[model samples]
Each structure stands twice: as structure tokens, then as C-alpha cells.
Target: MSQAPRRTVVVLAAGEGKRMKSATPKVLHSLLGRTLLGHVLVAAGAAEAEQTVVVVGHQAEQVREHLAEVAPAAVPVLQAVQNGTGHAVRIALEAVPEAAGTVVVLNGDVPLLRPETVASLIAAHESAARAATVLAAAVDDPSGLGRIVRDASGGLARIVEERDASAEEREIREINAGIYVFEAAALRAALGKLSTDNEQGEEYLTDVFGLLVEVGSPVGVFVAPDVEETLGANDRAQLAELRALLRDRVNTAWMRSGVSILDPATAWIDVTVTLEPDAVIDQNTQLKGASAVAAGAVIGPDTTLVDTSVGAGATVLRAHAVGAEIGPEAVVGPFSYLRPGTRLGRKSKIGGFVEAKNSELGEGAKVPHLSYVGDATVGAGANVGAGTIVANYDGVRKSRTVVGEAAFVGSDTVLIAPVEVGPGAYVAAGSVIAKDVPAGNLGVTRAQQRNVEGWTARRRPGSKSAAAAEVAERAAAGAGEVSEAE
Candidate 1:
């Protein structure tokens, strides 16, 4: 009886991503809601590999830190230098104890790897007992890729890089996909004799195929079902293309899961952004970074939510929310902004042109039109009218404003920071309140108005011309007296 085969996954994630030109490591740059490496690791796990190891090089500590947060169970090893892909694999091999089973190789930058594809490659390698098995694809143009050379029996014989291929060989459309599954013993022996005699002066993992063929061991090829899964991100343009593809996948999956996307083309949903059944999303809406929209939630004709959570039956109309949690049955603006730490309770209403930051509004709280509530706490059943501003920042420090239950704040009211309005209190319209109001009291800060009659007519264009003429006549009389004295 044959024992269960031991399989190990080796992930190559040591590239500096100079083309990305970002301070963050390449694999850490997010695709959809997850880092690229995160996707690769998930795929590997889904393939049912026994052991998985990640090789890290540039910004090793940062990569480790990110991986710890995203996937702590997977093992990690340091490459410690800028080396070729083959050399990176060798560094990863040090972490593996046995070399008898199969070794699966994957690229960290290729986030589209499917578990089925990887499983198929492993099956082909184990069943054929071949020294090496390569994933191959017939690309539109294999100009700069390694060409797959086949033997007389149509088995994969070797791989010739673009620079080394002959004129005729260069025209081959079947190219190496850079994904491979190798027999551990054969891989170790080949890597032992590998040399960096080429122009790049760096060991090439492709060299293992040639070694296997020369040793009378067969080198096999497995064609990918979809070639796009093999494409790796090397720059921002490719990264953007990957992002668009992932967004398309997310939107399509959501549609199939009973969500109605009115305009799928204009809608952008991150990889982990979830929309439950019956959820409707309008055009120009972006659900980003792990946001969740429950059933019956209707999101914008133009809305953007980042790291936000919208509960069931919530309606967000033309709003922008970031790091906020909107409760069930809540209604947020045609033009409202909810910033970090903002929470809107159930049945609450935030009307158009209102902004809230680091604030909490209780159930039934209403802040309608042209108001700014920051660093404040508002109780239940409270009503704040138009043009109300909570002066949260005083020159030196930020403060808070508190409004109790059933409080009525009038239009054009200013709730100075560090002030409070007690329950059942009413603030008069156009009041510039500077102090707290007791329960059941009415706060009115403005002095009595004194209106002068005909003030508007006095300032009209025609009346202003008459007033100018009278002033000119008086000046002329004074000039005449001065001339007589001269």
C-alpha cells in the first residue's frame, strides 16, 4: 500500500517591485480588500497542501508583520538577499525537512491562482512520476517569455528563454507560465548543481527543467484552463488591471448571489465587500475595504463607503462614509459625510449637507441640513435644525458637545464646544449659545434687533447717486470759499 503523499507549497514573494515605486512591499499592496500574498496563501491552503512556506527578501520585517496580521498560521523564511527566483526557492527549501514528496511553486504577485488549477498540477506531477511539471499557456504573444520545447513524443523536453531561443523557436506561442510542481528529490539534486553562468549571473528556476531532461527524467506540461490566472503584476498598470479584474469578479459574484446592481460597470466592489440578497446598489457607488451591506440596504446613485458597515433596511443616498457604522433603518443624506468613528443609531436621520466625525447619534436623533457635528454625543429623540454648527475645535484643543434626550436645537444655532443642552430644553432660532441650558429652559443668546426704516432703499443704486451729488455740492461750496480767500 502507498502512503499519503507529502506536499509542500513554496511561494516566491521576495521581489522589490521597483516598478511599483512604493515604499510598501509589493506583495503587501492590496488587491481588492486583501494583500496579494494573502490571496496566494488562501489558494495554497485551498489546494490542501500539507506545508506552506513564504520566502521574503526586501522589507522582510514589514512583510512578516503584515503576514502575521493577515495569516499567522503560515510559515515564513527569510531570503536575506536580492537573488533570482531559483535562489529564492532554495532559501525556502531550507525550512522543509523531507525531500521525497511534491513541491508546488507559486508566485506571490499572481493573486488569481485557483485551487483547482493547483490541485490539477499536483495530480499530474504525482501520477506521471515526472521530475518536473510546468504550467503552460498559449498566449497571444509570447515575445519576452520562455518558450516551451517539446520532445518527439510531444512531452515537454525543455524551456528556452527569449534571449536563448533560436529564430524559429522564438515564434512558439506556447510559453512557460512560471508555475511548476516538482518532485522534491529531483528538485534538490538539480538545484545542487545549478550555476549562474548566464548573462544575468543569477540562478534560474527554469534551469531545473533542462537538468531533468538531461538526466533521462521526463519534464511534463499542464495547460492552464484560463491564461489570465498566470499573469503576474510587475508594475502599477498591471496592478490596476488586476484590481479591475478582481472588481469584476466580485460584482459578478454578488449579482449571482441575489444582489441587484443597477449599474455594474460603474460600481466598484472590493474583494471582501459583501452584499446580501435583495441589496441594491446604484451607479458611481464604491463599496471598498471589507464593507458589508445587509439585505434591503439601498446604496447611492453616487456614494463611497470605506471600511464601513451598513445594517439591514438602511438607505444611504449620495453619501460618503469612511470607517463608520450605520445602524438598521438609518437614513443618511443626499449629501452627507460620515467620517471615522461616526455611528448613527437605528431609525436616525442625517439630512443633506451634514458632516459627522467622531460622534454618536442615538435612536430617533435627527440632524437635518447644513450642520457639522464633531466630537459630540447626541441622545435619543433629539432634533437639530439647519445651519447648526458644533464648534468642536477651540484654538488649542478639541472639545465635545452633548445634547440630551428630546432636546430641540433651533436653526442657525451654535453649540459651542464643551457645552451641553439638557433634556426637554429648546434653543431659539438664530441663537449664538455660549453656555449650557437647563432642562425645560429656553436658551436665547441674541440681543433684540433694532430695524431702521428704508435702509434698503437708501443703499439702492439710484439713491446712492443722489447722495453722492449732495456730497459733491457741499465740497464745491467749500472750494469756492477757499478760492475767494486766495
Candidate 2:
């Protein structure tokens, strides 16, 4: 009986990352939506690997915690000391337990490496039937990287680290990407012969290629299609560069698939966000974290949506929404805040400067301009006017307000909860409502109009106001006298 080949992946996430200038582990640093190591593990399918061993050192426990959440099946092996890459992999393999099939080793810091690239490397490694394969990239500036030295037949001769490279070798445009595939048995054998005799006084993983070359075992090289994928973030500046590359990739894909991104540079879309065809994303927008926009929806110019859904034909302009749902053809904001639990039905409107929290607005309902709606329900065709407030909180607890269908809540009105306005009711402007308004009734709470003449002139006594009032009074007296004489 032929057994399926077992594949193992070893991730090197053990660097201290002193260049990053932080307490956090290098692999734990996040950009876009995922940590550096999380991205690598996902790209490599480490979770589904027959076996995965993660080598952790600096902040090992923190990295272990992250692995538990993302790739629970992965086995973590602590390298208590900050050793070299060769030493880290040597320790990681000890935890694998399997001595046959294939072993893939990769650095966790290269978050931009794609799954397709990884698949290609493994395929190339097996097809060549070599003892080991090293992924290489020909970059414009290979200054700090290890240069790839090719033999007469173009097979990998050796990798020369920059610090130890001769002037001619440093000029080689092709650099080692620090990603590799090796036959399990061959990798285990080579690691046993590694020594910490390098300039850095650390065991160099690239040294294994030299040992294999001496033994006359062939070494393979797979040049990556995209140099950006071979990049690793050593500091904050490099991390930002990686982030920009990823952002461009995601935005370009969305644009190519019928979604319109008005300005790619200004718009930041998370990898998890989904956009259907005909969706338009305007400048300075950020769609993040499980958010979805259906076809014909237009979002942005300054909007940010996190964990929210925008329905078909909906328009969300200059708004910030989190964990909310905007229904089909609905209109939200020029400056609105939508908190978690908000739901707007079809054709609803949440106008400029409105803030909604834990509320539901039925179809055709509107909370227009400069209002706060919290813990409330507004029925179909209801209109909550500008400056209106549905006060849901008392001293101790929160309550809910209900506005029935066809109800008109006037501007500057405050509907104090546990209250309701019945169907077709009208709550007048400037009212402070404590009780419910019955069907077809008008609720009025403001005091009756009272006139205290010359109040501005008497109380304020401003020179400009007093002068204007005196002149107006003289003109009125003159007109009255002239009418009497006629």
C-alpha cells in the first residue's frame, strides 16, 4: 500500500526585532488586518499541515497565544535563546517527529508572500528532485540581503550573506528570500553538521547549502515572480511599506472586479471586506472587518465602516458606522455616527450629524439632521425632525421609545422614554414629552407665548439694539398719526 506523502511546515518566528524598538515580538507586529506571523501561516496553510512546528524565542508566550487563536493545530517549540536561523530550524525539526516526506521552512516576517507562491515553490522543489530548494528574488537593491551564487548549470552554488560577501558577490542582483523547501531526511542530516563559526558567531542556515554542495547533492533555486512578496519588515518604516503594497493589491483586485475605487491611494480596504459589482468607493474611505457592500452602493469620500453592511443602492457619505446594517436604497450621513445594533430598513434616511445607537428605523422612516436616536424604534413613514432626541437613558437604566407609523416628531422635540407617539400623531416643535400622544392627536409641551416688550432694549441695553428699537418706535408713531389725520 502506498502512503500519501506527509508534509511539514516550520515557521521561524524567534527573532527579537530590536530594530522595531518595541516590547512586542517581531512576528506579533500587525499591519492591515493580521499579524506578520498570522499572514505567513495563512499563506502556508499551516493549520491544515500534517504537522506544523513554530520556533519561538523573544516573547515566545505571546506568539504562542496568537498561534492558539489562529492555528490551534500548530505545535510550538520554544527556542529560549536568541539563536541563529539554522539553530531555530534545528530545534523546530525535533518537534516534528516525522523523518520522511517534505519540510518547508519560512520566515514569519514576510507577510506579503502569497499562497500561490508557496505552492509553486513546493511543486518546483519536488519536480526537480533536489536535496534542497531556496527561493530567490532578483531585486533592485539587494544591499542587506544574502546574494545567490549560481553554478555553471545555473543551480544554486551558495548563498553569501552581505556582511561576509566579497565585493563582486555583493554586486549580484539576485538575493536569497530566506524561504526554502528541503527533503526531511536531507534537512535533518545537514542541520547536524551546522556550526556557529560565522562572522556573527551564529549558525547560518545558508551554510547548509555549502555542506550539500560538498557532498555533491544538487541544490535548487526558485526565483519568485514578484520581488515584493520576498520582502520582510524589520522596522516600522518597512512595515508601512509592506502595508502600502498590500493595500494597493487589495484595492486593485476590487477595482478590476467591477467595484469602483475613485482614488486607490487614499482608500484603505481591509482584506476581509467584500464588494459586489457596481459598488463605488470614494476617496478617503476605509471599509474594514467583515463589512460587505452590495451592488450599486456608493460609500465614502470620508466614510469608515467596520463590521457593517451596506445594502444595494445605499449611499453612505462621510459617515462612520460600526456593526450596523443599512438597508437597500437607504441614505446615511454627511456626518453621521452609527453604533452597534442600529438597523435601517429600505429607503430610510439618517441625515447629516445624526447619531443612532441600538435603534431600528422602519422603511421610509427618517431621523433627519442633528438628532440622537438611541434604544428606539421608528415606524414606517415616520419623520423624526431636526434637533429631535429620543432620550433612552434615565439615572439607573436604559429604556426605549417608539414612534408609530405616519408619526411626525417635530424639530427640537425630546421624547422621554418609556413613551410612544401613536400612529398619525404629531409631536409639536420644541416639546418636552413625558407622556404618550394618542392617535390623531397633537402633543404640545412648550409654554404659551408671552410678550415682554422691549426686552432686548431694556435687558441688554446695547447701543446698537437700543438705537434700532427707538428708530422703529418713532416710525410706527409717525405712521399711526398720519393715518389718523387722513
Candidate number achieving the greatest lDDT relative to the actual structure: 2
Output the worst ten-in-a-row residue range by lDDT, candidate 1.
453-462
Residues 170-250 of candidate 1 have per-residue lDDT tens digits of: 999999888899989889889887888777777889989999889898789999999877877878998989888877777
Residue-by-residue lDDT tens digits, candidate 2, 1-486: 976657889999999999999999989998777899998998888324588889998998899999999889889999988668999988888876664688899899999999999988988887788889999999999989999998888878898899999999999999999999898888889999998877898888899998999998878899999999999999999999999999999999999999999999999998878899999999999989889999999999999999999999999999999999999999999999999999999999999999999999999999989999999999999999999988899989999999999899999999999999999999999999999999889999999899998887888686888889889999999999999999
lDDT of each: 0.88, 0.92
**Each candidate: how many clashes?**
0, 0
Clashing pairs for model 1 are: none
